[model samples]
Target: MELALSLGDTPKPFSLLDHHSGSQQQKMKDLGFCMGLGSTRNLEDLHIKNMMREKDDEKVISCSSSSDPSSSPPPLPLQLDLLPFSPVLKSPPPPPPPSLSHRPFPWLSKNLIVESGSQSKLVKVIDAKPLTTVSDGEELAAGEYSSPNNSNSGTSSFQMDFSSIFNGGRSFNSRKRDLELSVNLELVDATERDHRACSRGGGGMSDEDENGLTRKKLRLTKEQSAFLEDSFKEHNTLNPKQKQALAKQLNLRPRQVEVWFQNRRARTKLKQTEVDCEYLKRCCETLTEENRRLQKELQELRALKTNQPYYMQMPATTLTMCPSCERVATTTTSTTTTSPCQQAPPTGSHGL
Candidate 1:
């Protein structure tokens, strides 16, 4: 009985199973998961997946908060020293450009002569200068294109080449005596071609005087004049081809034909102007005659208007002398006497 009671306090197999099973199950749950839902990842993969999820959540929060522009501070500047080790990148200093005098180019590119495979210069400016020669001057003016450095040759290679212009030649801004290299260098060559030679090229201008000048033809032949007149009737102006054809047919030069046509046009214009002047004169005379006639008519009308009452009062019959007052008087009717003074002769004896 005692043994049974002691054992009763101690675990029985059936009761032990119940408590142990429950406790073991709780312990197992605390320790690790049970059968997975459907995961295919290992510990490392699952940890990575969890980290990615957390990063996505953080990104979502950041994006949502980013709407308030003032809320976010600017991103911190990247410190180069803090960055990973690299080739320690740095820009190299630029190489100096080649100078003009050191390697001379063609003075005039048009005159470049290619012999076999190499190029040679037909004409070039003197490289040497008056002072320490070209070498000293080149060193002083050695610059990338044009620079502040000025030498005896000028500013740049261009100024140096054209030193004959502003610096070498006569300029308003005169330089020091030692700097003037081009005192009186001629810029333009004299024209050697003769004007008479050009004039002698025409076919009709073959006749020359002792002075080597072509003789002027003052008159044209009757046949030539007639032909030119017919041509003038056809067209006032002539094209180059037509002029050439006309010259060939008339045994004349193109210049002569052209001048003749120009003269003919001038004459025609003058004749037309004269005819117009004559017509205008005739019109003026006709207008003057009409104006005179109209003026006479107007004068007659004005005089008739001024003397209208006289015509109404008097008749064109006869004139008489008044015996009473000795004054001339007019009558209205042709049958009445001309003299009829208003004053009665002694009033009572007026009828006598």
Candidate 2:
């Protein structure tokens, strides 16, 4: 006897044979997926057999459009038809699948655009200036230096010669970022130490190093580099105060801390977006399951009502399971009568 197929029933595996133009037709007579002239007419079945075609076309298009003309598209695979033991059965409408949430990250450009004929036109406005060599105990730049005449300090202004800060220097140059970072570290340390000690702390330090005559390249260990990267993810865009505190904790310079935080913030925002997407996906799945269950219950109730007699004058409540017996029975003014509709015995348990 032929086994009848229903919605969601799995079909027996069958062989797929393929025949096409410009290719020798081959017979796939084994029990595998079939795709050709007389295959299962079910759209889903056909889709399964021809799945490779979808991917194959993409490769063909990409090959045809290649910059080199020697590249040729591969020959299409032949279709196979699986013989069915019985007539094709109509399938039930499938529950709509939940859509997945796609999370995309913002991309940062790694390439820097250098303008033509203007490589040296832009001045590097960073660590080039010496932080320690400022005249007197007060070595503040024009923008950074506040008036000593302010009520906070209540002192007269003194001329701190800053002309030497960039004196005898090339007009515009781009040193390696690491070298600039080293300069920033030395200047911030020397200035901060001197401010606290109230004494010039340049006794052992060389004048050339202080005067930017010699630039030192700084390097970080693997562990230090990894730690800084992790730290920056927690704190983004630190100010002077925050930078100092972070540097104290990490034993790194404020400049290094600042750069790390900048990079970290960008990464954190991207990570947060991905996390949000996963959460939304779980929520979508939960909602989908709930919707499916509710739809199934509604269909069952509708089926039960349709089978009832039209003149029975049974209330809709009769369609519900009995409170005590948990059976589909209708209560009337005269008496409660159990319908021909019988609920499946609660699994293995028989009625009392």
Candidate 3:
């Protein structure tokens, strides 16, 4: 007879070969009973086969259960092998930025003109008058002796006497003695008047006035001041030759030019110091503001940490146990719904 089996309520014809051997026919019968054929002996054999299949499946499950999913071995590391002749790509370095020179004093920007010929003429003028070494008493006496002689002098004789006194050819003692011997009453009175005049009119005073106790302050002319300012702008410091040239140009002593340059340098330094101080003050203010802002942000973060909910901060995993097998399992969930492992077991043959 040709046997037909239904799978899921659909009937299909099942057939064995017409020339099948007994052992092969018996094997087909066994397979048919396992697919729900109603035969007592064949059903017993099918039951035994089902039991063996169940045991094998249980063994496979036990092996899988022995190793934990959480304890799975890390994935194999990916090896990167470099190929020969393969070009390596690299980013080129950025070009350097343009450099700027530092200028501390911005106001000193003018160029100075140094005239070589003018400087030479100044040196010649300074060399012409050697500073007098004669004492004040001798100078006074010499002046008195020359007073009467200068009145009559359209002559070579007067020029000779004047030269003899001033040219340093005669000794101071000889000049003083000659003045006292020829000193008339009128001349003595005239000397006293001249002494009074010298005291009253400080201008055009002799070298004795320069050597006196009082310090003389020389005022520079506006043109001289302007020239010095231009020179100072070109170079803060002066060489000896430059100093002498400037002094001659300004009709000032070399000492005066040296003092002016020293003062100018000091003023420039003071101005630079003030600028630096202002810059530092602004930087300090900016840092202080940044610090205050950071402190406020830190306080807000700390407050947020204190006020956050405890449940919101908990980890995503919860311990769970299977209802049918009572096996322990770890579950990761976002919601409060019970997982499949914690659900009630089904009724009837579906319990496994």
- The TM-score leader among the candidates is 3
> Can you tell me which runs of candidate 3 are displaced by over 4 Å?
1-211, 310-352
Clashing pairs in 3: none
Give per-residue CA lDDT, model 3, range 1-352, as digits (tens).
Answer: 1111211111221221212345633443333221222112123322212222210111100001111112223112111111111111122222212111110111111111123653311011111121222345333333331233444222111111222112122222432333333232223343344334344432111333445655434344333464466556444577776765554333345666788989877775555345434543554465467569979999998788678867466767665433332333565565444433345465442232
Ranking by lDDT: 3, 1, 2
Which structure among the candidates has the greatest lDDT? Answer: 3
Candidate 3: how many backbone clashes?
0
Tens-digit lDDT track of model 2 for 131-225? 23334321222112223333312221212111111121111111123223433334344334333322232211112254457544333433334
lDDT of 1 by residue, 1-352 (tens): 0000011011122111121235543432232211111111133322111111110111100001011111113122110111111111122322222221121122111112233346322221322211111123222222212222333133123222212111112211222221121111211110011122223332122233334365534345343565566555445567776676555444345666789999987776555445434543554465467569979999998799687877656555444434343333444454544323334345442332
lDDT of 2 at 159: 20
TM-score pick, better of 2 and 3: 3
Model 3: weakest 10-residue lDDT segment is 54-63
Could you tell me which 10 consecutive residues in candidate 2 have the lowest summed lDDT?
100-109
Cand. 3 TM to true fold: 0.32
Arranged by TM-score with the best first, the candidates are 3, 1, 2
For residue 326, what is the lDDT in candidate 2? Answer: 30
Model 1: weakest 10-residue lDDT segment is 1-10
